[model samples]
Structure formats: C-alpha cells, structure tokens
Target chain A: MAIEVRIPTILRSYTGGAKVVEGSGDTLNDLLTDLDSRHAGLRGRLVTEAGALHRFVNVYVNDEDVRFLGALDAKLSDGDSVTILPAVAGGAFGFAAAAAIAQHNTAAGRRTPVTVG
Target chain B: MLSIDRSIVDAIVAHARRDHPDEACGVVAGPVGSDQPTRHIPMDNAARSMTFYEFDSMEQLRVWREMDDRDEEPIVIYHSHTATEAYPSRTDVSFAGEPGAHYLLVSTREPDTEEIRSFRIVDGVVTEEPVRILDAGVDPHAVQSYMFGQSPATVDYECSGR
Candidate 1:
C-alpha cells in the first residue's frame, strides 16, 4: 500500500488536477521528494529554499498535524494519508471589501496583505 | 454539520458582527483526542480587509502554540463574510486544509441578523452539513467561572445548593 497524498485546490494545477495521488516512502520528506519527481515544481510550492516547510503551508499525516510530529521528518507508512494546505487566515469577505482595505492600507502606509497565488 | 455549543456559535457571530465590514477569523479549540469544539480563540484578521481575511502570522503562531500546550486541536476553523452569504468562496475552499475541522462561516451582511453555515472541505470538495446547535445546559455562571480557570464547584456552590 502506497501513501495517499491529498492535494488542496490551490495546488491542484501542479498535480494535473489530481486531488489525490500515491507515493511510497518511509518519511514525509522522502514521500514529498518522490512526489516532486513525478510532479515537477510541486516541492517548490510546499518547501522553501532552505528545505523547510513553507511558512504558509501545512501538512498533516493521517489526521495528526506534521508540525507536532517532526514536520518534514515525520515518518510515513503505507496507507497513511497526507494532506497539504496553504496557511490562510480569513474567508469569504467579498472582493470589494478586500480591495477597499487593500487600497486603504496602501494609502495609510500599512503593510498590505500578501497576495496569494 | 457537526453539533456545536450555542455559546461557540454566538462567539463566532459576535466576532463577525464586531468586525463589521472587515472579515473576522478564529478557531474553536477542543480537547485534542475528543474533538469537541469548546474553547473560543477570536483572532485578529491581519489582512483587515473588508473583502479578505488572513491570520496575522505571529498571532497564529502564538494561538496555535497555546492550543498545543493545552493539548487541544482546532476543531472548528471559522471566518466571516461581510457582504455575502455564509458560504465558502473558491479562495476559502482552496485554503481549507483542516479536513477534521468544521469550517463555520458567518455572514454579517445584514444589520438586523446574521447568517451562519458550516461545511466540511476535504480534498477540495465542499460538503455542507447540518449544524446542530446544542443547549449548553450548564449554569451560565458556572460555565463562565470554568472558562476563567476558576473552580466550577465554587461558583456552583456560591450561587445555589447543588
């Protein structure tokens, strides 16, 4: 049984719209590396140049958070399910409101929110 | 569509209302193994955008660390829609990483009332669920005391013979 990796909507394009894919490895790092080999550029989105999980990215094994389990070094097993998600803070507040805030913040000389791809 | 305490629902609504046109975001932390959404942690929307909301990275780190110390998990991850219905947007769906969490949405578009909804976002699929609002049943004062880390027994006995 291979590890099942679940991809989030934002990252789906890299997976060819695959919601779930299988990879084999003894650890999360190995699994992600294996996945990147098949799906180019996927690792770049999830990991930083320093080989660490992206600040805005989260990975979970089964139902336990990887951060609590050793992050990328967390061990993996066949049949384990992995999920990836971007670290976003809020939701659904209309685009108009966001635009207004962005404009206001820019005018007020505040740090504008990072625009996620 | 998991069952949640009325207080928890109220807190989320109150937060959304308080933030008004700007987006509000937060999480309900529950006992790690139990998955009960009990503790309310209202977060500051760093984006502070009327149309967008994002957690302040520093605040998120602090709150998440506190949850870990308390052996709690974010069972209900929630945010608000100010000018729209209580539904997850495509952006929201894209960020729904917590598969085990109940993604609760509260809309404060109306001045008179709020519209609240819940969904399970798993594998990029949004599944709306029925929210069973639970009556806490416990004495309000006792619950308050307990939340403040005070002994519930003291509050219960001080108020009445139990």
Candidate 2:
C-alpha cells in the first residue's frame, strides 16, 4: 500500500523542507502513526489525546475531509492522496472560534452555556 | 457542497455594497434540517467603516436561533467589501468558521455595476463557488438605503460573554 501525503505550510519545518512524503499502510491510523514515528512531532500536531482530529489542521483523504468522516480511523487506499491543511494565522482572528469550540466540546460535561462560533 | 438561489445572492450583495466604504453583515435562513443552505443572511457590522468582522452576540444568536427554529439551519453568511470586489481577503480566509455555510460577498465600488460571489473556505484556502445576481431588478430605493446607515440586521457575537 503506497500513498503520498501533502504537508501543510505550518508543519513544513518538522518534515525538513519536504512538502510531500511517502508512506504505506492499510489503515489511516497506521499510516499516521508511522508518519509520527518518522517525523518527530507530527502526530501530536494532528490528533488530540482522545483521538479526535484537530480543527486547526484539516486532513483530507483523497479530497474527502476526514472531519466529515471517521477521522483518523477513516480507511485509505493504496494510491490515495492525503492533504494536510493547517490554520493560517496571517489572517486576523484565525481559527480562534473553531479552536475554542473544539476545546469546549471535548471537556466532557453538559452544554454549560458553551460558547461557540 | 451546497447550492443556493441567485436572487438571494443579489439581495446580500445589495445590502453589502450599500455600506460602501464600511462593513455590513447578515444571517442566512434555510430549511431547518441538516444540510439546509441559504443564499445569504443580512447583518450589521459594529466595526462600521473599520470593516472588521467578529462573532455574533448571544442576544443576536438568540434572535436568529428563534428564526432558525421556525425555519431551518442558518447556512449562509454575508459580508461586505468596503473598497474591493466580492472576493475573499486574507482576513476573511483566516476568520472562517462555519465550514458548513456559504460565504456571499458584495462589492461597493459601483452599486450599479454590482458584483456577487460565493465561497467555501477551509483552513486558509478560499474556493469560489458560482453565484449570480437575480431580479435585484434595479432598485433606486435600495441605492438610497445603502447611502443611509440603514444596514441589515446584525447579531453582535464578539461582545457576547466579554
């Protein structure tokens, strides 16, 4: 199973100037876990501790957003392409609302008058 | 991932271009079930001429939610272009939150030669979706409304909890 994953602009430094990388795996988690083992801080950057994907970083499997799907557990194909999109900060008020929503949603409690964008 | 009517797009652009050198805003109403989409939602920008956009307030959200309860999910977001076209700017791309909604932009340079465009932005990339102006049918009254401070209804979310 061979696949190509595109690196987002924010995390390019971790991959040492390589915008694209190659990996092989039957499952999305296996591939991402392998990528993290090879690239120091990638996994931590992409997934949260409870296994939910970060909104700041969008991972697309063959142009399909993982957020709308099964996230990291989403299956992959041999020739599928993975695109990593990072939240850009050049624009003012970048991802603060989405990040806040994500942080608040995962806190494990009732609505609590949770603030959302 | 969604499609909306052109007439609604025109209404959104109309309200936005009226703000001319300032910012305008509105909410989009649609069928209440999941995936319901809107062409545009009218809004009032607190920043005014500053042209900055922040979140909507609780009271405002409450009003829209009430309307939404009567209707469907508020699926589209409309904003103005103070000095430019109906295109996405760097700031617009960054502050995008409702990935599930459509973005409508109206250029204010020449209301007569109005422009409208829809977009879906994720992360930092802005993807333009096709949108056309409809029976907006030449309204001198709307033109006059634009000059006055009569902006579309707005919900102030930035100062909601703070």
Q: Could you say which candidate leads in DockQ?
A: 1
- Model 1 Cα lDDT, one tens digit per residue, B1-162: 467776666656667766677788888887876757777887778777767787765566567657767888788888988888788897787666677788888877777666777788887898887777778732344222122211111110011111
Candidate 2, residues B38-102, lDDT tens digits: the string is 42445545333324544333324444446545655556676766556567776677556556566
Which candidate ranks first by lDDT, i.e. highest?
A: 1
TM for every model, in the order presented, reads 0.61, 0.45
Off by over 4 Å in 2: A1-117, B1-3, B33-41, B132-162
Candidate 1 ranges with C-alpha deviation above 4 Å: A1-86, A93-104, A107-117, B137-162
User: For residue A41, what is the lDDT in candidate 1?
Assistant: 92
Q: Give the clashing pairs for model 1.
A: A89-B55, A90-B53, A97-B51, A98-B51
Judge candidate 1 against the unseen true structure and give its global Cα lDDT, from 0 to 1: 0.73
At residue B11, what lDDT does model 2 achieve? 58
- Top-TM-score structure, candidate number: 1
Location of the lowest summed lDDT over 10 successive residues in candidate 2 chain A: A86-95
